[model samples]
Structures are given as C-alpha cells and as structure tokens.
Target: MTDLCVEVERAPRAALVRLEGDLDKVSAPAFRKCLAGLAEEGCVEVVVDTAGLAFCDSSGLWVLVEHQRTLSGMGGTLQLTGVHGVLRRVLEVTGLRPLFASQL
Candidate 1:
C-alpha cells in the first residue's frame, strides 16, 4: 500500500484534484475525502489529475466510478487527466474511458 496524497485547488467553476501516490484499497478513503470537498463546493466540473498516480486497485476504480455517477446526478461532470500505463489500461478495460472527458 503506497501512500496517497491529494491536493485540491479550486477555479471559478471547477476544482482540480491532484492525485499523488498509489490508489488502492488503502488509499480509497483519502480519495473519497477529496471527492467530498468537490461535492461540498458544488463544483460544476472536477479535473482529476492522475499524473502522479503510482498504482491502483479495484477499490480505487470503484471510487472513481462512484464520483462520476454522483457528479452526473448533480448535473456536474468529472474529467480525467494525465492517465497512463496500467491505470489507463484498467479504465479502458472497464469501458469507463468514454463516460468522462479524458486527457491522456
């Protein structure tokens, strides 16, 4: 379980959530907290920067999908950026790549 650190920054109508370190079961809780901030702010759009992500697991993917669903239900959106390698393959395999705007 690699350490996960999230840094959040807000823009006019969007929030940038930078995800650093591994994303797995151990880190999912912290990931959730990051999303909670976005929800609290009622951000119209969320940009999840995964450039620093070192790893991921099913639990991590589940959280992402949940956040996407929640944002859509709230009339907002979640966008992904800097995804690559194994994580990118996982998203592609899950067929969730098309559901959100992706910056690969």
Candidate 2:
C-alpha cells in the first residue's frame, strides 16, 4: 500500500492540503497533526484537495469531521475539492456531504 502523503501550501487566507495515497488508521494521525499545526498558525480556512487521494477509511473520515468542527468553532471553514470515486461515495453514504462547502 502507498503511504499517505499530505502536502500543504499555506496562503494568507487559507491553507491548501493536497492529499495523496491512502488515509487510514496509520496515517490519520499525521493528517490531524498537519491540520492542528495549521490551526495553531492561525489558519482559519482550509481547502483539502483530494484529487490524488486513493483511499479513506473511517478513521480518516473521523479526523476530517473533527477538523471541520474545530475550524467552525474558530469561525473558519473546511472545504473539499476534487473528491470522486470511493471518497465521494463514502461521504455521500455517510451523510457527511453537507458538512463541507459545495463549491469546488
């Protein structure tokens, strides 16, 4: 299995996290840590680009849900883009689609 890799580019208003490979139990902590670091840096808006993400298990989804809650509490937002295939179906099936902004 390909190891999960998260590439982050911080902008003045938002942080873009491009995810690649599988986001599962082993890699969820890394993903959470990246988001936490961004939050500590006063990043309010986060855009997760999932174009290259190959897989996402429940643990990964849990991290994302928690992150969204955290960002929302800080008066920020988490948006997702390039979600398709299994990831898209997962969101839809889990009724988590409405949690993220629809645009992009």
Candidate 3:
C-alpha cells in the first residue's frame, strides 16, 4: 500500500496541490481533507500536480470529480497537471480527460 502525500502552496485565491504515491481507498480521506481545507480557505483556483502520483483508483477519481464540480459551482476552477501513464489512460477511457483543465 503506497501512502499518499499531499503538499499545498497557497497564494491569494489560488492553490497548488502536489500529490504523490497512491490515491486509493485508504489514502483518499487524507486527500479529501486537504482539498476541503483549501476550499475552506477560499481557494477559488486549484491546480493539482499529479507528476509524482504513482497510482489512482475509482475512489480517487471520484474525489477529484467531486471537488471539480464543487469548485466550478462556486465559480472556481480545478485543473490537473503532469498527467501521464495509467492515470492518463484512465481519464481518457472514462471520457473524463476533457472534464479537467490540463496545464501540461
């Protein structure tokens, strides 16, 4: 089980979150908490850097989608960067690749 690590850099209304390791059932809670904190801090623009992300599961995807919708509804945005390998394929297969703004 790869533990997920989340690091955030905040700036005004924007934030950048760096994710590493596996984002699965066990680690999703931590990731969710991190995002929730950012939202509560009034971060309107979020950029998730998945360059160090090793693996991601359905639960992880759900979290991402949930936050994306929440941010969009609040007139905010959530984008992803450094997407590649299996994660990229998963997004593509699910037709969710287009849902996020890719900064790569």
Candidate 4:
C-alpha cells in the first residue's frame, strides 16, 4: 500500500479532502483521522477527492460510510469525486453508489 496522504481544503460551502495514495486497510486509519477532523470542524458539506487513490479495501469503504453517517446525523452530506477502477466496481457491486453523491 502506498503511504496515504490526505489534504483538506476549505471551500465556500464545503470542505474538500484530497486523497493521495492507497486507501486500503493499511492507510484507512489516516483517512478516518482526516474525516474525523472535518467532522470536528463542523463541516456541513464535504467532498472527498479520490482521483489519486491507488487502491481501497472493504475497511476503507466502511470508514467512508461511517463518515457519511456522521455527516448525515449532523444534517450534512458527503460527496465522492473522481472514483475509478476497482473502487468504482466495489461501489457498484456493493450497491453503495446510491448512498453517496458521486462525481462521475
């Protein structure tokens, strides 16, 4: 797994988290940390840019889902951007695409 890097940028109405490297089990904790920070910041809208993600596992998916739940509980939302390859298939196979606002 590549060393995961997450960079957060603020937008006018949403916060964007740019993901770099693999988003699999080995690095999912870091992703969770980033997401938690955003939650703590009282973000009402979030965009997770996965354009540079090399890989992701079920654990990663769970973490993201949890983040979405967190946002939803707070009357917020989470958006997914630039998903591709296996990650895209995972979302389809698991029928989780409809749960998120995805950027094709």
Candidate 5:
C-alpha cells in the first residue's frame, strides 16, 4: 500500500493542502478530517496541491467531489494543481473536472 501524507499551509486568502502518496480508502478519512478542519476554521478558498499525489482511488475522488460541492454551496472554491497521470484521467472520465478549477 502506498503511504499518504497531507501538508497544509494557510495563507491570508486561502489554504493550500498538499497531498502526497496514495489517497485510497485507508487515507480518505484523514483527507476528510483535513477538509472539515478547514471548514471549521472558516476557510473560503482552498487549493489542493497534488504535486506528490502518487495515486487516488474512487474513494479519494469521492472526497474531492464532496468537498468541492460543499465549498461551492458556501460560495467558496476548490482549485486543483499538478493533476496528472491516472488521477487526471479519473477526473476527466468521471466528469468531475468541472467541479474544480484545474491549474494543470
């Protein structure tokens, strides 16, 4: 199994969550908690940096989708950067690309 790591950096206007390793079922809970923490902190703008994301399963995709929906409902935004390889294809194929602003 691929190890997962999440690094968060908060800025004045937004928070950057850098994801590394595999984001599968085992790690989705951590990702969700991170998002929940951001929400509780009243963060309105979030940018997820996928520079080190090695793999993302369907569960990971679900987390992203749910967070994006939640943020949009609150008039916030979720931006994705460094999306490539299998993860990129998954987003495109799943038609979830429109849910986030991609900086690839």
Candidate 6:
C-alpha cells in the first residue's frame, strides 16, 4: 500500500505527469482529479511517466482509459512512458496497450 505521489509539469498545451507508488482504488480518485484539473486548464496532450510506479489495479487502469478517451475526444493525446512489470503485462493481457499514443 505505497502511497501515490504525483508530480506534474505543464507546457503550453501539453503536460507531463510523473506517477510514483501504487495506483489502486484508493488513489484513483486523486489521479482522476489531477487529470481533470489539467483538462480544465485546456491541456491537450498529456504524457504520463510511470517509471516510479510500483503497482496498478483495475481501478487505476479504468482511470487511465477514461482519461485517454476524454483526451482523444477532444483531439488530444495520452501517451505513456517507463512502462514495465505488472502494468506492462496487464496492458498487454487486456489488449489495451494500443490505446495510448505512445509507450515505452
């Protein structure tokens, strides 16, 4: 139950969010709120860096998918970087890897 830590860096129309620790049902709400704040600020492109992420549950995945859909609908994009371990496997197993604009 590692606490989630989020760090965001904003650009003109894009943002880079670095996520650390576990992303589960408990932390999804905070993550969702962070993304919603970016959207409200008119951010179009979002890059999520998960190098420090230790775990992710279904609730976390759902939040990501939801935000990806939202950004896509607005002609924006959501990309992921530093994917590995369980998160990588989950995305692959769920066939949801292609949903993001980029991955690494």
Q: List TM-score per model, in order.
A: 0.92, 0.95, 0.96, 0.93, 0.94, 0.98
Range of the 10 consecutive residues with the lowest summed lDDT in candidate 2: 95-104
In terms of TM-score, which candidate is strongest? 6
State the lDDT at 15 in candidate 4: 96
Say which prediction, candidate 1 or candidate 2, comes out ahead on TM-score: 2
How far is 13's C-alpha from truth in model 4 (Å)?
5.6
Candidate lDDT scores, in order, read 0.87, 0.90, 0.91, 0.86, 0.89, 0.94
Instruction: Please give, for residues 1-104, the per-residue lDDT of candidate 6 as tens digits.
Output: 99999999999889999999999999999999999999889897999999999999999999999999999999999999999989999999999999997765
The residue-by-residue lDDT of candidate 2 on 20-42, one tens digit each, is 99999999998999999999898
Residue-wise lDDT of candidate 4 within 1-104, one digit each (tens)?
A: 68888888986557998888888888888789888877887876998998988888898999989998889899899989999988899999999997887785
Which runs of model 4 end up more than 4 angstroms from their true locations? none
Please rank every candidate by lDDT, starting with the best: 6, 3, 2, 5, 1, 4
Ranking by TM-score: 6, 3, 2, 5, 4, 1
Count clashing residue pairs per candidate: 0, 0, 0, 0, 0, 0
Q: Model 3 segments beyond 4 Å from truth? A: none
Tens-digit lDDT track of model 5 for 1-104: 78889999997657999998999999999899999789778786999999899999999988988988888888899899999988899988888888797786
User: After superposing candidate 5, which stretches have Cα over 4 Å from the reference?
Assistant: none
Better of 3 and 5 by lDDT: 3
Candidate 1 lDDT over 45-80, as tens digits, reads 998999999998899888988898889888889999
Task: Give all candidate RMSDs, comma-separated.
Answer: 1.2, 1.1, 0.9, 1.3, 1.0, 0.6
Regions of candidate 6 where Cα sits further than 4 Å from its true position:
none
Can you list the residue pairs that collide in candidate 2? none
Residue pairs that clash (backbone atoms under 3 angstroms), model 1: none
